[model samples]
Target: MKKLMMTATALALGAGMAAADTIRMGTEGAYPPYNFINDSGEVDGFERELGDELCKRAELTCEWVTNDWDSIIPNLVSGNYDTIIAGMTINDERDEVIDFTQNYTMPDPSAYLALSKDVDVDSGVVTAQTGTIQAAFVADSGATLVEFATPEETVAAVRNGEADAVLADKSYLVPIAEEDDSLVLLDREENINMGIGMGIRESDTELREKFDAAITSMKEDGSLNELIKKWDVGATFD
Candidate 1:
């Protein structure tokens, strides 16, 4: 009888813990306007703010953690974090590994930018950040693709003339090109549409559903639109 009572108490305790209503989220904290460390050494960005709002709407406490971009997905799958609020693009390749919430950001194209006027990006040699849709595009297009660890490295390759052009998200590259006159965005006839979404562990369909519902509600109520306008996010949703 004592053993049975103890087991019942443990089960009740476990249930209470599970119903605590806190969601821990992960982000790269290096991707600007999405998640990044500001001058104050604090994480602040569109995704961060949006995640906080979503948690509020869902009546859950949110804890944000900084993670490296390359390892974010792996850590998420390992249960190190409950959800990934990073500006992760939802691609078919990634879908094989993890499930994603309904896309919160609209799809935008990736483009090529170069620092050298004489370099012919049209000749089909380019560098892209590894594991991105842009890298896949370059590979499929038969370009001599050089993979870089980060966007900064890809941009530096272009500046140093080591690469003919750097392919990245147009929204990010456009602001960078505008800031640095040495780089020019190539006028391409084709652009790749990539939708960014929040990631969750494959088994966490319940959490993903909550996120999707919250995002859909925000979108319907104009809160999401207000956030986009406040952050000046380059893309818009239909």
Candidate 2:
């Protein structure tokens, strides 16, 4: 009888240990200012820091994994990650697949970048990553649209004159344009804000609630705002 009790206690202890809190996070780790690999090859960016902070607040161990932007969602659905901390814009289309926390970061309007004197945002054809908001804009405006695999490729296309304009996140383009005098910023006056939130599996309501609480605490304490300013992330959380 004593042996049976001991065995049951051991099993319960093991189960408790297995259920100890740990969170695996996914990010592109290539989108600068949001999340990217640093020169040291470690993930670094506003989103990365925010994830770390939130995990700390929730008393959970965090393990970050890098995945391609296009596959981030699919991986989350497959249980490859407990949550996605990448700079994913929260939209109705995405909500159909996964549940998201409240908006932690807001999106800025997609902007155009082109080589000086060679491209026109209003007249020439513009290209963006296929299935992106910028691509939707191109389709609606009847502009010639080109597709690329990555943001880097789209920017390269503009530089090489393969595409007249590249529409992407303004925060990404502004820094690149400032560094390269050959590039010019277009559509500075447009403001399109898209809310960005953490992605979780459709059934992970418990985890989602924890993350949402952490985010709400961060925003209330001004930590989120400070991180946004420190990183120069294009959009505001408020």
Candidate 3:
């Protein structure tokens, strides 16, 4: 949901979202099925489609902006973007920094990926994307947490034996595990389950309401569920 690129092209893209009627939709453009840069180098994925629809429903012009995951929230607070449509999980810690619209996605389980099912994920070295809840969980669980800048790097750490396992959203890992013969999902203990929502600045009450209403409409009309199933991200909002 977050990635940072300060190239001239990205800056121009950000400027486009700054138009009077355009709501900047910030994302990581690294998390697949959620957000990613496609072959055309444009933001493309589930959140891309969902954000566009939400903006349309809210009667707001919107444009996509990519920022690094580690600085996603900070950039939003700094007025670099109007809202974060990144696949951010709403939680108490995050709430202190930004206000989230009603959740667009239900809670998803985090998973552990390793080369073997029998790996001791609880105590051995684990890799997680920097600035994610998965990293926090590993830190507190007494495991040696190796942080990576991107999700792919986290997976690479495990594959290269730099870490014993990679912990991340199960939705993101399932396909990788299925495609790779050497990787397997370790038996999970009810991992952190949290609803994913769009992050808006704390002071943007009216804007938050606009998005919340749009999300509510999507839920009522069943389009949100269709998108969730289509993207295979996780269960729909309930």
Each prediction's TM-score versus the true structure: 0.86, 0.86, 0.90
Clashes of each: 0, 0, 8
Judging by lDDT, tell me the better candidate of 1 and 2. Answer: 2
Error of 1 at 127 (Å): 1.6
In model 1, where is the ten-residue run with the lowest total lDDT? 1-10
Better-scoring candidate (TM-score), 1 or 3: 3
Q: Write the per-residue lDDT of candidate 3 for residues 1-238, one digit (tens) a residue.
A: 1112222222222231333656789999999888999999999989999998887776676789999999999999999998998788888999999889988888889999999888898789999999888989899997899999999999999999999999999988998999999999988844585888999888777678777888888998889999999999998766
Ten-residue stretch with the least lDDT total in model 2: 1-10
Q: What are the clashing pairs of model 3?
A: 1-28, 2-28, 2-69, 3-28, 3-67, 3-68, 4-67, 4-68
User: Which residue runs does candidate 2 get wrong by more than 4 Å?
Assistant: 1-20, 188-190, 235-238
How much lDDT does each candidate structure score?
A: 0.75, 0.76, 0.85
**Residue pairs whose backbone atoms clash in candidate 1:** none
Q: How many backbone collisions does model 3 have?
A: 8
Positional deviation of 209 in candidate 3, in angstroms? 0.4
State how far residue 11 of model 2 sits from its true place (Å).
18
Predictions: Cα RMSD each: 7.1, 7.2, 6.8
